[model samples]
Target chain A: MNSNWHEEAYYTIRTYEIDSKKQATLPALVKLMHESAMQHVIKLGVSVWDLEPHHISWVLMRQQLSVHRLPRLGEQIKIETYPSGYERLFTYRDYKVYDAAGELIAHSSSTWVLMDTVQRSLARFPGFILEMLQLAPAPELCLPRPAGQLPKMEKTDHSLDFVVRWHDLDYNDHLNNMYYLQWMLEALPDELLNHGRLRAFDIQYRAEAQWKDQVRAEVQHLPNGRMLHRLVRPDDGKELALALSEWE
Target chain B: MNSNWHEEAYYTIRTYEIDSKKQATLPALVKLMHESAMQHVIKLGVSVWDLEPHHISWVLMRQQLSVHRLPRLGEQIKIETYPSGYERLFTYRDYKVYDAAGELIAHSSSTWVLMDTVQRSLARFPGFILEMLQLAPAPELCLPRPAGQLPKMEKTDHSLDFVVRWHDLDYNDHLNNMYYLQWMLEALPDELLNHGRLRAFDIQYRAEAQWKDQVRAEVQHLPNGRMLHRLVRPDDGKELALALSEWE
Candidate 1:
């Protein structure tokens, strides 16, 4: 909140954003964090529009989120996001969510890579964007690393097939990352999803799916009481995302 | 916007709310109107929280909407909703969406009935709410009537079964109405969906679907290039909603 590199945004939990318990859903927090990221880049003059001429766009690769407790309906929440640093090809961003009472509710760390829209492959960092995200090196070392390669699923307990619809696409015309998580959550049992709660989650993206694409979401029960998930394209058999989630 | 009976709220298009063209989606407009209606009742001290103790809740019966144009992403728009009037069993509400320049972009009319949560049936209007929604009767005559009985489907061209997930439910513990519209949109052919555009719609709710229910969304192509839509529970075959849509 003190520096030009950090951007802060405020949001109120809408009725639709809550669950049956009247607490804000994890998807709501993800949207807020992403919105804050967009706001930060727009202010830094490196937004999608600014990079579009060069056919460059940001593609999310990995994300980790932990929730102390979900905020209740009508609660005013503040989101702060800033770049942690950039490695060879990935930029690190961290997010913090606080309630109106100034208590931390949730926090997240994400990794994104520059993509050449025309080539559909990772692109080198744009010098201008690198210059704007000047985070000190020491802090990046303390941040939790983005979810790395996930373990192979031993067996799939639940799986669902989803054909990407127009509503699943975002302004970027690509399926929003949030839908992947929602599909993962949907594969969970009603006893767990309705009765249990998501305590933490880690996800790593492997590919992108578009409208009308048939993608299969699979969930495996891990040995340690966690759930491992994957979104895979049925036609090409390409993995779209790999994830691990903890339930309370 | 001029009177206490009228509630106005402003919204900015979000990245997740727009289609590939960067124009706001119909579901986005629906959320805005509902949010504005919530704001209106909150101001009148008759919000859901206040009525919960009485085991009563508002249930949408019918809605009609027309769009002049969908707002672009990041564009600021204003939504105004007010109670148009109320008959013995139904309360009427109207919504208008305007862009920053004050040009009308979308308008809607809706009818709602009160439900007794304990009894699971229609309930008489509460005395307090009846006093707040006082509109002069003359203007009510000019407003378009809420969508009445819809023509039965001749034959379903496309159908999709959607198992209501935890994310699909709202604070009311019932499936959000927006999801019904989304499922209907999903049932349309990609040839019509990806290329064609929705210009207007009228929907009437027949029953409420809760979590874990498998509802089938079916759409039939009409002879006049329109579409007839229905959301029905596969168990009891209860019609959840009947809708008609006109596309550009």
Candidate 2:
């Protein structure tokens, strides 16, 4: 087996993956980052198919992505990912996206947890799984780990209520992470989304949202020009996700 | 160039494309069919890129899909498409999807109209465009042209109001055809969606739906075990689209 831990994958930005600005959407970029991570693990022989028999699966805990520029439609880009390191009850991974010219376009870091699918509880990492990954030496990341707790703002400048639809649910029976970013950005003023570009964003998932849940997205424009977003279930007042976005 | 008008393309169903039943969603299938048709037109040297300089584009007017079975996740399927014919103010195309075993899974037919993007009106088809296509003899299709007018049912058994979101808008600056199906099926009773599979469906686009438009989908259960759906804008009382769905 190769000692090198990093794996690379290439993707073409499809028209459907782009937004009205003709730039790739945040959800599309996140999907590429996720597929890259999956390919990396599959290269290590630890794919979801490999773990299914053990009744174990990997669940994303938190992710932070910083973009230099979003790719445009029909642009071919490369994604490089590697297992960074492990912390208590969480595994770390890092991703970097590059344009055709090898210029860095985006960088992201994510934390994942192993879960027992049947019991719906956190599961301890198996030694064999760790052995297969052969985690690379920790490298400095462009962005720091997402903050555990975001500061509460005085007032929400914009808010919208969204019903979790069938299309929002993934195979895991929970709302996909991309929708969190969608709802967050959707709540922003049209002037911002239409004119500006997303430069940096981080999301911390606190709880799983299921189908038919009414999610309320609230956003506050901070004094620093950053946007703070919170997605909560109105029924139980459960916070589903929190995010901070910076635009250029 | 060879005179053969038919074209074939292959697609691998991705995990994200499937629903709870592990089968491909209607939108994914429609996307594949649309992509296949685009590729076919491009091969004939009349792609959107080719038409952009002329400020002209092709817009879907109507489509009917009949499914023998929905493809499953990770399944490789073949899509065959060809220009069937051109009638008064409309060009017709047909598509067939086959599973790995070469068994027909679904078949679809669509009608399109040329649009003058700058004028926002239908344009008369140019003779050169027809010359480029070299339309083959019309092939027998599994489904006929979608009815111009769906019957107005007496009462709506289920109804839901949906606001057009940013994600719902495609490059055309209108609601994607797939979302029309999604919202229509979404309004159906859970018993129909969960216990039955969509066998045949047809939709006719009457008007474009813009972002933030408050559209209501009303569905009625026909005595023949079919569901009739109509989407209309409450503000102007204009019908956006009409659909009829058969479940097995």
Candidate 3:
């Protein structure tokens, strides 16, 4: 897909954006995607004024991102985004990341929905939405599949439980989505988390948890050298999330 | 507002939960809240069995909370949350926070919206949602006023424009929300933020910002000894956020 409807912006890499590992953190990437999306929307002239009096806000439902090469400390990166059009209820966008010389480092696709703030309903795409999107035809968004699915929930046997801590919260008072991926990986033994590399994984958020809640995480190793993970509440046996991870 | 509900849960504060200022960090609070809410939902019968197939997720829309007194490091806080009924579009929940000795520390109100994960649409309340949430009687949610609007955007009237650094980014790519508050407080003349006592104020998240994005923050002294702060993207002249801060 191709169209003239495209714009490019540049951002500098800052020291604070890097984590203890000295790499840009995944949460930072999530934040970047959000800001970039907003910038794209603003370029389309859909400011807060474009929404109805009732408040219109963007809510992240689910995201699947892949990082082939992470930018190093003090390295500058350029991120480009294009509207890939919409699926039934979601507007799809694709992103291509490059280093200073334009070497491809990552590619991603995200689905977004417009919401009615007051009625708390899914808002239909206003004509201005297209206008706000300033749609430009772009290459189809092709994201790499994370590792395949592990067996059913019963297959994963060993499990761990943790109490929700005050620091685990976000502005919304829920576990930040990216934080869960960390927990999903952290549940693995130190040998796996420390030496093993995260080849790929798929995580599905099942329910929201709050402070002081007890959460249970279960893990299993497959003969194929992959691990299956699940998080739940042991007291009532509530499953919070599930993921299939492969590491070396 | 008073509550007759006998809800009780103890949250053990962790060291990571404390910010540079030695206070419970707000992002951590958000994570705990997510766990708490999920536990509540599970108890209401919305289990993994009911959640699969349809990927559904909830994101915070808006929240109003007041902190009377923040807990010291390692303090175990008890937080009680009860449904406060629904407003125009949000499922409202109210929280009562207590210190180890049972002294009230803060009261907060939060609003949330559910979304269809794959479709990324504003998903209406599932049939079981109201039933599940309504298990507890509606309690009073004392709403807080918006923090004083940040003073009008100016050329930093003696301020600094910071390009967000990597370290500043959390798992979420955009600058951490708490950092904004911290930045606002930091921009204040050392005379203020360095004070020993923390009084009260309410802040709201208007939008997310990116790294290397130049932020211009302006601080003005309000007539009542409070401060008005505005953070703006100078390159595009867009207001990223605003805050009204008061201190003792």
Candidate 4:
């Protein structure tokens, strides 16, 4: 039985929680929500051993979250999550984030897909996981998908290169998103982010690159100053990932 | 040719940069230093692709950094790094971190190994890398060995479990050290981190883990209140990493 049940699990907020708006950053909030999901899965006893070698590890395919209210720094909040079943290619998980007084602050849902680690091939959820985690079949919850397919590159006229560093590799021995974002943002013309602030960003992971691999991320500057960034595989023209960022 | 041989690079400090001492944390500093190294390599055209895939990859086997001072919130720092040369089992890289006034605040050197990513084996640096990047042989430069090993864990009877998340994974889909440190620190029984402050912490990476991997970290408390923490694979009980944290 899951020991860390809802009646026993709770998380407290720290003074360092707020963003420049004096509210929590979406990225950080997403992190906490993800943590809550992990806690829930652990409570259910689903672990690493259940993983298959062909396991295409789950990646955050897409997420849609809406905040009815924002929690201030130092405000203790509670989170509850539940499995909402799977679709053709994605497993859905839903969350409700609440403040101490039991007021709902935000509600979110995300889609994830398991992929073969080495081959980078997509994989279906294993039946054992579905039973071990007690993730019973349920009707899929509805949420809006990210608009359009990822913007394509018209051309690769120029590129910026980046080296893989030891610290750059995480426990999975791949690059971290924040640092990857940092590199992509840094590669952009500084004036763009030099005095500006990042409003929102959405990135999709396409493939994994190893430590010390030489990578060239190409950027396409649109007329409006927004950018479509592609992290490319120089050995093959495989587009490893795409990122879209908006700044003001 | 490195076209922007002298073009200045920039980075901003966010609130997350501060550690328990309210100073820029060492791991974060190492991350920034690594970022500087990547930026430098990208500008030099030896970015990721120039690397040999199977036989050679860079692993930060060890690092030794000395900081004369630390940066506070809202601070912007500039950094520069270059390849110093190679030693027997490691490649040496050096860095200079400066404040806004161009005052040098930190000087660091790190030792990295060329590894085979797929087989998890070490490889020798290929000759083409040195030639293509116009790097000269300077085997004299080497990273100073770390002062001590992670204190051995004597508290084998105790264990703490944590759920892993997406934010915990970096671009390569591995958990970042900062998050591991965050987990280790956060797991400190609460009474300690809340009452006292963390003075210093040094840890070493022994192995890498994937996303959703359940981790069990054990801490050995000394009579004087110092702690030795060890993270282990939940199943086979292999030591993943270890750490020592001093509190006041």
Of the candidates shown, which would achieve the greatest lDDT relative to the real structure? 1
- Docking tier of model 2: it is medium
Higher-DockQ candidate among 3 and 4? 3
The TM-score of candidate 1 is: 0.93
lDDT of 1 by residue, A163-217 (tens): 8778888777678889998888888877887777778889998888887789898
Candidate 2: pairs in clash? none
Give the number of the best model, judged by DockQ: 1
Ranking by TM-score: 1, 2, 4, 3
Candidate 3's residue-wise lDDT over A214-234, tens digit each?
A: 877778887666788788877
**Cα RMSD (Å) per model?**
2.5, 2.7, 24.9, 20.5
Q: What ranking emerges by DockQ with the best candidate at the front?
A: 1, 2, 3, 4
lDDT of 4 by residue, A72-130 (tens): 64467887776666666667667778888888787766667776777777776677556
- At residue A238, candidate 1 shows an lDDT of 95
Where does model 1 exceed 4 Å of error? Answer: A1-3, A135-142, A147-149, A223-225, B1-3, B135-142, B147-149, B223-225
TM-score of each: 0.93, 0.91, 0.44, 0.45
TM-score of chain B of 3: 0.66
Q: Which residue segments of model 2 deviate by more than 4 Å? A: A1-7, A39-55, A117-120, A135-149, B1-7, B42-45, B48-53, B118-120, B135-149
- For candidate 4, report its TM-score: 0.45
- Model 4 alpha-carbon miss at residue A206, Å: 34
Kindly indicate the candidate among 1 and 2 with the higher lDDT.
1
